[model samples]
Target: MAHASGMHSLEFKLPDLGEGLTEAEIVRWLVEVGDLVTIDQPVVEVETAKAMVEVPCPYGGVVTARFGEEGTELPVGAPLITVAVGEKQPTAGTGDTGTEGSGNVLVGYGTSEAPARRRRVRRERPVSGASATAGQTGAAGAANGRADAAAAPVDARAAGAAAAVDGQAGGPATEDGPVPVISPLVRRLARQNGLDLRELTGSGPDGLILRADVEDALRTAGRGATAAPAAEAHPRVPQTPGPALAAPGSTTAAPAEVRTPLKGIRGAVADKLARSRREIPDATCWVDADATELMRARTAMNAAGGPKISLLALLARICTAALARFPELNSTVDAEAREVVRFGQVHLGFAAQTDRGLVVPVVRDAHARDAESLTAEFARLTEAGRTGTLTPGDLTGGTFTLNNYGVFGVDGSTPIINHPEAAMLGVGRIVPKPWVHEGELAVRKVVQLSLTFDHRVCDGGVAGGFLRYVADCVEQPAVLLRTL
Candidate 1:
């Protein structure tokens, strides 16, 4: 849609922040309404389930409208902002409207000169008499040198339908035009549930179908009634059949329920942990080890070297060596194929508790890295976790996990395996304890080590061997010398 002043509005939706993230919480807005932005400029900071990221704008122009406020969670493909572009506007320093935006969606992508392609042109159609007047007023404002005029709200369903008719935002043309569904996940969900996309109206911007729409459609179908009526009839019925809520408008006093929606990082963690518990028949074996030698080795290494080696790094090195001895523990089960997939390279993930939630950042090819390199990588990932800067790539593809819960002052825990991975090695706190060493009684720094493995991947023997090797390294640090 173009204004009389030769300016047109382009809606920039939230692009797919990879690793299958569906939504993000708006943490902050970098640009305000009417702010001039160049292509690829960071316009908003959003917190996805995995990390916090600054979403860059692909269009260069005056930001005419801001869509969601800070703290609002929006699905992917939701409209983020509307930019008004004109011949006078800066098109990524070209100052020509003919040049398209810098093809960058996320950070570290795109270029100065993007390929020239026609922008998504909104087909002009009258939604209502009031809509026509609103459009005219907006155009007049632009023509009268008012570049800050807020965009008129487009009837998203109507515009989506129009876009479908024009073959711009649809899939597989039909008599009623193509379905205005862009997300393949949404299509798959609908297909799996035997729901037709054409019958349901989308709640997203531009009438694009979303996963929530499919879920809602399924829920309505299961209930055999419209959502509004069902919701009104049983307003307090819990969806998953937990405790029954108090009757609506009941005079009886009930405890005030403070419900927090599990959506972002918490929701992701919940889903993964639940899946791990549901699928993996896991068993944990723990052993107490005298870690006096390992601690002394770390201190000596730090005293003799340029950089200090973290205790966690030494433990990680031990884990890599242990995994080398028993690769069965460093693998995943292909449930569909019913085969155990062992990895040659060990991508070691360490659990770090952040303000967001529990996150496991993986160090790629950890088996090849020495103690020093492992220390550096662990420090980098730990700092990234603390500052909420760990990317999706940093958080995934782990063949094995090392969780050091000692920082939390916990003795030991049978940690749930990180889903799809075969096993997790948990390290407890090292503290002073009495022990007999070399036929003498003395106090030694003792630590408890636990290995939790999927029972299907390996038997008790393999799991015990892996744990014994790790314990042996902790007890005698010299055992790592052979591997070195």
Candidate 2:
């Protein structure tokens, strides 16, 4: 029997995992072409909004071909893998199910449902809370029980010492017996600092090792420069900031003292931005436009119960419209393939600022959606973004991206292009400024529009015209109505 369709080849494209994602970065390939894969076996690892996730092969078969290189951001619905449909599927547990199939593209970031078969359930016995049953657990059970019973009498002293070592308590106690008593916290601290608990003197209630004792041990140990003691050599992992650079346009050469740890979405964005800048040839064009009419349109839309739309939403509508007109700007430049691949759908990604970092969630089929639909989708995406509830699907698959720096009161900025896609649009702050209309000087709401495109795929002329089209839409929002 064959898996999925009876055809010999099954094209497994990228799927929309959820949250309206349109694209994803291939983190690593777990299986290569020609390797056999089982149904629902993890084949590749990809990074989306919050975490790195493994993608499973949906069918069991030998991988015939693999699509898209690792680190390449591919559009949703693009074919990623092809499996030999009629091949005999190896039985379960053989590790022969074709997880080795190629990758595919889809609109969403997450799977709609859990795969039918993932892994077999483990049957390890559960833990019993009480040490009294330690004898039944395993070989160490008897010894554990004896230790627990023997420590009962000194439990209070040990706890007090642990507290002291943690800097919660301070005291001095005369030795009552030869048996050394210690708290778990103190033991843990000593273990972390690479100190031997046996050599430390106790200054806690009931003659325990207090914070001072631990500090003294560390100081003494540092002076000796000897190998860390057996009791305290536990390894520790601490997070630190990344490399730093000097601030821009600074006369002084003092480097930035404060550094931010690059991780999560910020880390992902930083890497992509650096790659785009290094690889893509960029050309930018700027235009100023009057947004007075656009503001009016927003007010009217709000009155019509069209979800509180922002100027950014208006700009997005314009970009989608222009992409439909100038499909070249909506295309991607495949440098390695030596071809320009155009997309059939406009999966638009909008730069949303969140507490954690900047997240770009896609609006799938942006060209097909009306203004109201886009507004609602944008609202949902932004709300999910702010609350940190966006799924992997929400953050992937974008044919074009918009970065609205204007919301922060900035005039304009040259946003780096999101790779695999040729261009990015940056919308700046809108403010009332003096304008000469016809023959008279008057105040008008104006905004700066900056378009940065990959010069390898789009020339300066195309970028400028794209900017002008967006400005025209903002200037005459009625054009958006015509598109609808």
Candidate 3:
């Protein structure tokens, strides 16, 4: 029996939700503890450093306990929602799940789930001038009220009928309470009949006025008193001729233009970057260093039959080593909790220039990979990124970032901090310049290295020291050998 009761535990950790965000706030939960959940089912909505992202369960089973609650702030790698392993049919509204939390990162896009609740339809009665006139007078008021009740929850229809009856009695109907919010369709219908929007109450969600509500209002208004029929349609209509109808046998040319709305990654990227700039406190620092040794190392490594790695790759290795010493540089700002998360792994993001602006494809487990492996992986990722072949996994889990501007002939640039991660290192092109070598002036391969980090995480001293460490490694690749 014990053997038959075997169970598998799946811990769904939070992943990079994009815009380089490192953490998120739990916005809402779809399921509670002890409830059954299917694999790929949506579990919760988390507002990341950039946007609200819905994370789905990867495995099906009972949801024993959710790790956090609504409003709880969670970090990447933190257990989000857990599921038990079982064979359950794939269901609609099921989210994408794979390999525990090691699923593809989707480059920079996050997922969305269907809204938690379904909408309910509302019903209301209709009113017209002809009905109002016949039902008005003392008898008409009663008739309209009966009609409104028969129509369902619309008080407006009843009220309108009462008014028509009163009008027939040579007096206006007693004014009712404030107008109800009616649905858009109802409002449009009433407008077609020249109906006032203020006369109806809404029966939709949160008492929102629905089209039916307006119809009910109109219906009541027409119950007892004689009145003209409401307008057949909205009063407003464009006078200009629409596209001419094509001749039966004539070929029609399509419109000479097209429009497509931005979505998915592009949409997600825009929202995230906007949010990052709005929420995070940013600071940038710049410095020029002699990179003679960095160039030598790259050439030697390439000649050694290793994959050709860019200066950005070398910078990644140096930044990873430096972050090891100053882990604080690898931390994230938790504005909601007023805290910071110092990460244990170095997932570096390389700002690869693509046809569609700049995209930062992340290198996961950077701190653990050796230089040669790092070179190959960087090559693979950049090539994939540039060629638009990056799987979701190739673009996420970044703990830090690097942007190289030297390739474009720029001497130096202060790059934006790739958010959540405390800092980003920028490497510039190698230019020959006079330098002091062995206490003498000589030409050396000098490249500018600018470090932009979140000042909230590091002070000038800490940031400066980190940059100096990178400069040292670039000046002498042998130094990276020791640091590694």
Candidate 4:
């Protein structure tokens, strides 16, 4: 829904991209200040800790103000652009009070207008004392807020005392309006925690309720339940430090190293790995597979077909088949629920090295795709990964991962498990080796296969069984045909 179809400008802010992320680095801007943008048109590209995402503006109009430069980092709820809703010359000095924005805010961004005129909990700037301590998250946001330019004006009442949840007129229009929130996830989070949405202050643009707001309320509730320590309650404190680090005769020296900011794709990778290690009790088991038969089959198929099949596609087919027999390996451990999440469809993620860093692009419904289809899809994703255009949706939500370290000329490795996913299958270098074939000594192409999985999902017996099946398929392509 467009803002009150009059001359009103709406403020657009950076939305919280879940997983406890606070801010993002602006990679590029798609629109200029005077650019005419339509509803849901992407205005800027931002790189979060996870992936590069193009944020689309829900309200359409003339871009009045652009915030932050290309390399500047802006926190969640910080202003990004001010769009004068429903006006062509949407900037200031047009003398048009641009109001009315399309009441439709996408789930990707923030703020949606609903007719349930429920007022948001009044939130104010944090001051000194207990209120300041309670506003820890908000304080962080304020400190990190980076806006290069001032935004255009709209209804001042919308942001001041008269500001309603739905950036409408000064005071509350109806006592029955729903809370302004775009993401269902925020609603779900509040629901799970048994928190009431009607009574929380949203730290989002236009007073939109966000997950952070609900989480903060929970934190405050938890603190209220605990008695403050005696020393913290009321005690005399010294202004200087106790000097615990460098004791009387102790000497300290600085170490030399290059520092890198944990932001963007690299940061995302680090966070995921750390979480996986922390939550999942993982175990790795590996076996050497004879790829002589699978390689020959691939060669024959490529020689006879118009479209050549990739070795990766062949291995992926085997993986899907093996997973079908051992489904436990294709699941995730939900600690909160104390259950294993098993999916019917196989979303296979393959590791690919790109200019940005190492990223795993998922193949949706790998079980449904044939070798030829898998090859084409992999090729397309590889190109997308290289060009650094892979979206947040593309880089996530996989049941399992296939790591082809063979391309890197490695024999074997205990690759880290991708968080949330149960397991990862690593394919190592394939080279000619001496082996006993059908009672005779012969040279064959042997490859090492490693499977790293969450022990919480299944035991070592199941993991070994899955790896054995994969090896069987590689050694005898016809073994895979039985399941096909």
* Best candidate according to lDDT: 1
Stronger candidate by lDDT (2 vs 3) = 2
Kindly indicate the candidate among 1 and 2 with the higher TM-score: 1
TM-score of candidate 3 to 2 decimals = 0.47
lDDT of 2 by residue, 5-82 (tens): 322556576676555446666645555544445556666665554544566776655454566655455666666666
Q: lDDT per prediction?
A: 0.73, 0.62, 0.59, 0.70
Candidate 3 lDDT over residue span 1-484, tens digit each: 0001223345567776554666665655656543445445566755433333456665554443356545456677777654443322223354432334324332233335432221111212444565534433332243333211222222232232222212211233232232343222233355446777665555776677765565566556652211222222212332334378766654434334333223334445676577778766777777778888778878887888845676666777888888887888888988889998888888888877753235678888889887767878888877765544465456666788888887899988867677667788888888999999889999998888888888888789998898888888888788877775
lDDT of 2 at 11: 57
lDDT of 1 by residue, 1-484 (tens): 3343445577788898888888888765666654446677777777777776778788865565677766578799887887765544354434244457766796324555543322333333435677766764764454343223334433332334333222334443222134765343355456545688899999877988766787788776752211211101122333343266657543333324424456566678899999999999999999999999988988899899687888988998999999999989889999999899999999999999875679999999999998889999999998888766788889889999999999899889999999999999999999999999999999999999999999998899999999999999999999999999
| Model 3 lDDT on a 0 to 1 scale | 0.59
Q: Each candidate's TM vs. the true structure?
A: 0.71, 0.52, 0.47, 0.64
Off by over 4 Å in 3: 1-264
Ranking of all candidate structures by their lDDT, best first: 1, 4, 2, 3
Q: Per model, how many backbone clashes are there?
A: 0, 40, 34, 25
Which of 1 and 4 is ahead in TM-score?
Answer: 1
Winning model by TM-score: 1
